[model samples]
Target: MNITVKFFSSLMEYLPRSVEGNAMAVQVDPGTSPRQILARYRVPDEEVRTVMRNGVFLPEEDRDQPLEEGDVLTVWPSIQGG
Candidate 1:
C-alpha cells in the first residue's frame, strides 16, 4: 500500500533531506500504523502534537490504527508564538 506523510513546522526536519516540501510518498505493508511511520522516520513521539488522516483528526489512541491506501497522514509539532 501507499500513503502520503506530511510533517509540519519544526517537525519537518524529521523528514529525509531528499523529500521535497513537507510531504513524502511511502510504500508500506498492510496494517502499517502512523506510529510505525513516525518511528521509521525517527520522529520523536513527544514532538508530535497533532495527527490528521485525510483531514480528519486522529486521537492518540487512533494513531495506531491501520492506514488505508491513498491515506494522507499529516503531523504537526507544538507551536509557540506571542
Candidate 2:
C-alpha cells in the first residue's frame, strides 16, 4: 500500500533527500502502523509529540493501529517557547 508521510517543524529534517518537500510517498505492508513509519525514519518516540492520520489526531496508543492505503500521516515534534 502507498501512504503519504509528512513531517512538520523540526521533524522535517528527518525526511529522506528523495522527499523534496515536507511530505513523502512510502510503500508499506498492508498492516503497517504509524509507529513503524516513525521507526523507518529513526524518529525517537520522544521526538514524536503529535501524530495525525488524514487530519485526525492519533493518540499515542492508537499509533499502532494499522494504516490504510492512501492514508496521510502527519507528525510533529514538541515545540517549546518561553
Candidate 3:
C-alpha cells in the first residue's frame, strides 16, 4: 500500500532526498505500523514529539497501529522558542 509521511520543524532533516516539502509518498507493506516506518527511516524516538494521522492526533502508544492506504502520517519535533 502507499502512504504519505510528513516531517515537521527540525524533523524535516530526517526526510529522504526524494521527499519534497517535508513530505513524501512511499510504499509500505500491509499491517506496517507507524513505529516500524519511523524506525526504518531512523527517526529518533525523542525527535518525534507529536504524531498525527490524517489530521487526527495519534498518541505514542497508538503508533503501532497499522496504517491504511492514503493515510497521511505527520510527525513533529519538540521546538523551543526564545
Task: Give the top-scoring candidate (TM-score).
Answer: 1
Worst 10 residues of 2 by lDDT: 12-21
lDDT of 2 at 29: 96
* lDDT tens readout by residue for model 1, 1-82: 9999999989989989999999999999999999999999999888898999999989999988999999999999975679
In candidate 3, stretches whose alpha carbon ends up further than 4 angstroms from where it belongs are 79-82
TM-score of each: 0.93, 0.92, 0.91
Q: Give one clash count per candidate, in the order shown.
A: 0, 0, 0
* Candidate 3: pairs in clash: none
Residues 8-55 of candidate 3 have per-residue lDDT tens digits of: 888888898777798899999999999998998899997788899999
Off by over 4 Å in 2: 79-82
Measured over all alpha carbons after superposition, the RMSD of each candidate to the real structure, in angstroms, is 1.7, 2.0, 1.9
Question: What is residue 58's positional error in candidate 3, in angstroms?
Answer: 0.4
Q: For residues 1-82, what per-residue lDDT tens digits would candidate 2 score against the true structure?
A: 9999999999988999778879988899999999999999998888899899999989988999999999999999985689
- Model 3 earns a TM-score of 0.91
The per-residue C-alpha lDDT of model 2 at residue 15 equals: 94
